[model samples]
Target: MNILITNDDGVYADGIFELANKVKAIANVYVVAPDSEKSAIGHAITIHNPLMVKKVNFRNTDIDAYAVSGTPADCVKLGIEAILEDIHIDLVLSGINNGPNLGTDVIYSGTVSGAMEGLVQNKPSIAISYDGKNISSKEYEKGAEYVVQFIDKIKDNLTMLDDTMININIPDIRDTKINGFKVTQLGIRRYENTFEKRIDPRGNIYYWLGGKTVELEQDENSDVTAIKNGFIAITPLKYDLTHYDRIGRIMKEIQPLDI
Candidate 1:
């Protein structure tokens, strides 16, 4: 099997390197990622700017790698469409992310967007993240190992429908023993945002965005709840955002205007 790996954390990040190292033992691995961190960039493709890709000598690994001057989504799209066009990719894996991408916060996550892009191209994809706010290289290695184990176990039996991808969140392994895996849904996650106004050296006013996550009551079968309980959260996500059930009701409520 051939697997293509990409991440918003960039091609040089320890998380991606460790992940590629482990996965290469199981299958052919190709690494294509952003040159710099593109966190929270979502599923944006670079259209205005010309995307420049450079061949990278990815650390101690022999895996074929490239660093793209674009978003995470662009890396996958370019990898499939241009870079690795001749290679038949069996799966796409995004991340062993430095931080958690849980709940609705995934809406802004470039990590998730990388996998989503692969799914858009009709490939089975997965996004894996470690629930650690401040993590070390060792922690990233542990996360990568766990993800590889999980992938190895499910590679043969995994079946996904069209327009769907798997989002996996691993609990922090520093102090917690992983109980198991829980297949769950995306939970509500909100943040209390703060914009701090500051004066620059030249007396220019600037504002920096910062926020803390707001705690909320979550369902038992939610990704957030599972991660809190020391379980790996595995949520199957769909790219389609249309509310199918509401379409009929909305159409019925509004009368058609005749011109």
Candidate 2:
């Protein structure tokens, strides 16, 4: 299998490197990622500015790697459209991210957004994250190892023809023991005091983002709840944002404009 690996945590981060290394043992791997951390950037693409790509060594790893001067999604774009244009990309794997990307967190997660880019191009993708206070290289390795095994299973059996994305979040390795993987749905995870007002030395007021968690009710089958229960959360995400059930009611309320 030909795989493209990327991350929002930058090209030199342990998580991306570990993931690439682990996947390399199973298939042809290519790495293209942002040069600096681009976390919480969502599914943004770099268009106005010129994107720069540089071939670099991934700490003596043999896989072909590049650092892009753009967002995490841009890396996948360049990989498919330019860098490996001729290669048949079987999958795009986007991250063993430093933190959990569960629930509504996926909406703002560049890690998940990176993989979303692949789905846009009709390629299957996976976004993996570690739910730890401080993610170590060991944690990254564990995520990579588990994902590698999962892919192996899919490769041997699943004959999927649809473009889809899988979001996976592994629980913290310390304190809590992993129960196993569970398919889940996205849940609510919003932050209270999302902004903090502050004054600069020059007395200019500025508001800094203070995205601290504000706990809300979540279903037992939610990805957020699964990670909290020591299980690896796997959710199949869709790109369509339409609420089909509300469409008819909305149309009936205002379709034949009277103005």
Candidate 3:
């Protein structure tokens, strides 16, 4: 299989490196990622500014890699349209991210957004993240190993889909301690936003953004709860944001006559 990989943690992050090496054993891997970290960038693309691309040898891995000077979405877009147009890319994979993209975190995750872009283009895609434990660094060998195992499990079905995407979150723990995988739903994972006021040497006051993770009490099927209980969370996602269940019932309550 031909797999295209990208991540928000830059082309040199250990998570992406580990993932590339591990997945290469089963597929032809091509990585196009930001030259530097672009965390929490969401689904942004570099339309106004020109994107710079450079070929680089992935350390300890003989996979094809490109460092892009843009967002994670930009890397995937450029990879498909400009770089690998001649090659048949069967799957678009993102992450093995440095942090967990759980629940509402996906709303601000470039890792998920990278895979989302591929899904938007009707390609089979999956976004994988390792629970970061609030720490910025991660040892992704075990997580990467699990991801390869996941690929082996689902590799046959990748070519059979056109409009679906999957999100995988691995716990930040020892491999042997991991319980198993759970198909989960989005949980009420949120953040308590804060800003700290401070004065610099120039006597100017400024506020820096800060927040703490907050997970609301949810059912056991929630992704947050699954990870908390030591299971890898797998969520099937779609690009449609419509509240379809409410539309018909809501329309019945009001009459519209060019009002």
In Å, residue 178's CA in model 3 sits off its true spot by: 1.1
Clashing pairs in 2: none
Measured by TM-score, the strongest candidate is: 2
Residue 6's lDDT within candidate 2 is 94
Please, what are the lDDT tens digits per residue for candidate 1 over residues 1-259? 8999999999999889888988898999999999999999999999999999999998856899999999989999999999999999988999989888988989999999999998999988999998886888888887887888888777886565356899999999987889988999999899899999999999999999999999999999999999999999999998889999999998888868455
RMSD of 1: 1.5
Each model's lDDT: 0.91, 0.90, 0.87
Separate clash counts for every candidate: 0, 0, 0
TM-score of 2: 0.96
TM-score, each model?
Answer: 0.95, 0.96, 0.92
lDDT of 3 by residue, 1-259 (tens): 8999999999998888888888888889999999999999999998899999999989956788999999989998999999888988888989978878998889899999999999987788889998865533345877888888887888887764566688999887843368999999888776798999999999999999999987578878988888888898989888889999999988887867356
RMSD of 2: 1.4
lDDT of 2 by residue, 155-249 (tens): 75433625568999988888679888898999889878677799999999999887688889999999999999988898999888889999889
Off by over 4 Å in 1: 201-204, 256-259
